[model samples]
Target: MPFRINSQLAQLIEQHYPAVKTAGFHLSPVAGLTGESWRVSMSSGEMLARFHSPDRQISGADRRREHSILRHIARHNLGPCVRLYSSPWLLVDWLDGAPLAEDAFAGAAQDVLTQSLVKLHHLPLTGYRLDLQQQFAHYWQHIDRRRLTPAWLRLHKKMMRCRPPAPLRLSLVHMDIHAGNVLETPHGLRLIDWEYAADGDIALELAAMVRSNGWNAVQQHALVQRYVDAGGYRDLVLLQQQVNRWLPWVDYLMLMWFEVRWQQTGELKYCEWAQPLRP
Candidate 1:
């Protein structure tokens, strides 16, 4: 079984959140990959309680970083996002909906996602700070001790070598846009899991989603066209080239991210899917 919330953390929450204390908080496992998140039920409504890994070495600052990004997104009304109730442990206004599982090109889900990305790209930054190379370097430093294969090493080096494109446009990026990260709510689609959020090329957001979700050629083209139509394509060819070159990097980082999560929660599925990216 995966890790469960300790009694101490539960008490901390009850002490802090008024809603949790009055109606009393009911804790159940919230399906997530990294960090400890739970479905917290109170008299008012449902909320998500996410706990950062206490390890001093990793994920300690992740909570704060995610908090900042979510606040930025929420303030600008970037997307159908959950409201931030607390740092790391957010009390999102429960959006009753499902994950969009259709092909990336079809249905309201596609439109929701495309429009959300465009909105995010145009939103002005308040205090978002991003150092992409340093971020990946930190992950690489931690994972390098495990005897990485030669091909994987090559991918890492190449990813690092690909510098920020000149005349680079800077805007908020969700960084990770996989199927599960998006929720199809009745109000609209709300994006969850802002852990890997950052400020970078908006194209990177679309590219990451496309490559990570394994969108087919037709679906990929459709999504890209939608982005272009939404004013995301002054330099479409360059953006596509950069996105293609960065695929290995994206794959490797995602694989390692899962590997670390497995260690944290004893969740084996994270490592199971990592095999495809293995050299």
Candidate 2:
């Protein structure tokens, strides 16, 4: 669906970007998991503006960090160039390509995705460490207490006590990685949505990717070996162990995220998805 921007929204975009001749601009809505995104077409070029999620309490997103990360990565060609950024709104060059679909993401797609992620993982720290414990605490506090079953509380307590493997090394890790987030763009494979991106252990990112994609041991090992082969430093055994150790945390985080999203949108799908994930 196209985002028909009213005069108010049009003025807001124009206020931040006056260079685009008033001859006109258009907003076309783009579908995504979080945030309201619209592709803005102007005389200069196409840009995408993302409004922050309505309930930041649940998302635990820091737009300032996201904006900084985008600016930092775009220079390295790992992501899109930042067009403009202000509170609640981040505008960047519209990535012009389809997401790496499952069929297309195999073989060759895997190669480039691995290559790009290695480069991304090697970048300088974004000065923001991802405090999953702190974030989880925040979310758990917000979720309706009535819905917290004894089983769920038991699992949550266990998760809270479980300590993940220490960071072998920290880098600018793109916390969100998957086929959908990787665009097969004209330039190359570009990773979008840096909201959850932060400075963290690279293994955690890999673990999250593996868990999110439902990859088995063989496939997960393929990713680990791929990273190592792509010049990304990894202790073959240690990294594999770390990935396995982090899987429970990853799964729990995903479940909580879905629960929070379900609450935010009142969307049955999000709730339905969370059902199996619940305790």
Model 2: per-residue Cα lDDT over 120-164, one tens digit each: 888888799987777778778667566789999999988788776
lDDT tens digits by residue: candidate 1, 196-241:
6767766566667776777766666677777777776666676666
How far in Å is the alpha carbon of 45 misplaced in model 1?
2.0
How much RMSD separates candidate 1 from the native structure? 3.7
Backbone clash total, candidate 2: 1
Q: Which candidate gets the maximum TM-score versus the true structure?
A: 2
Worst 10 residues of 2 by lDDT: 1-10
After superposing candidate 2 on the true structure, give the runs of residues whose Cα lies further than 4 Å from its correct spot. Answer: 1-8, 19-21, 32-35
Error of 1 at 255 (Å): 4.0
